[model samples]
Target: MRLIKAARALAGASQDELAQEAGVSRQIVIRVEAADETVTVDAVEKVRAALERRSVVFIPSTAERGPGVALSKTG
Candidate 1:
């Protein structure tokens, strides 16, 4: 949830923009960022895909660090 919020913020994307990009509803994006348990995995994946398309690279959490996102160099 935190990662998604950060990605959108850094990408300068509004919820409506993300929703359009993900082919989901703005409410779904809202629920996702809020960490709502009812948000489906499919919806989350769609949002992730959309972020990736916008050059948001998701980083895995290692023992010494937390999960985070970075911008792709090509973007």
Candidate 2:
């Protein structure tokens, strides 16, 4: 993913280094890059924070709502 690549480049960090900083194992970072489903939200957040420290912008995904539609359900 671009996020992973950007994090690695911005920190001048290897997978091992970024994994350590993000409190995950090198294998986890590799799996995440490979788009493995096993990666957890906590791990993603840690990696995102590490990238954010280097001024990388992380834009989270939001549900696609049609125009004039509210997310919440109302009676």
Candidate 3:
């Protein structure tokens, strides 16, 4: 995932370092960076946490946003 690599770079962490921080193997980082489709949620969350620690903001895309139900402002 570009996000992972970018976060790792931003944090000045090597792949191995990031893997260790995320409690995963270096291979997992490599696979994730390569956009492997089999990545797990745990791995993604780990990377996300690592990025968040470095103040990396992750905003959900519009497509990934919830259904288009409107919210009442007075609620």
Candidate 4:
């Protein structure tokens, strides 16, 4: 998803770094970011969690705006 790439960029992390953080392979991150339908929900969730752990907050899309990411202000 766009948010994944954005989050990674915001975190200043490489795919390898994110994969290590998520406990998944770099290929998994690539697949998920590519929006490959075959990628499992679990893999996607792991990637999301990894980003969250780095303070990347995922904002859900609303009628007025599309989904987005933000860095958390908290510790």
Q: Pick the candidate with the highest TM-score.
A: 1
lDDT of 4 by residue, 1-75 (tens): 877999999888999999999999999999988889999999999999999999999999999999999899993
Ranking by TM-score: 1, 4, 3, 2
Instruction: Give TM per candidate.
Output: 0.97, 0.65, 0.68, 0.96
What would you estimate as the lDDT of candidate 2? 0.66
lDDT of 2 by residue, 1-75 (tens): 655765467557788877888888888888877777878988887876665665555445568732221111221
Please report, in order, the local distance difference test score of every candidate based on alpha carbons: 0.95, 0.66, 0.69, 0.93
**Model 1 ranges off by over 4 Å:** none
| TM-score of candidate 4 on Cα atoms, chains taken together | 0.96
- Which is the winner by lDDT between candidate 1 and candidate 3? 1
Return the lDDT, model 1, position 69.
Answer: 94
Which is the better candidate, 2 or 3, if ranked by TM-score?
3
lDDT of 3 by residue, 1-75 (tens): 676676567667788877887788889888888889898878878866765665555544586573222222332
Ranking by lDDT: 1, 4, 3, 2
Please identify which of the two predictions, 2 or 3, would achieve the higher lDDT against the true structure: 3
Model 4, residue 64: displacement in angstroms?
0.5
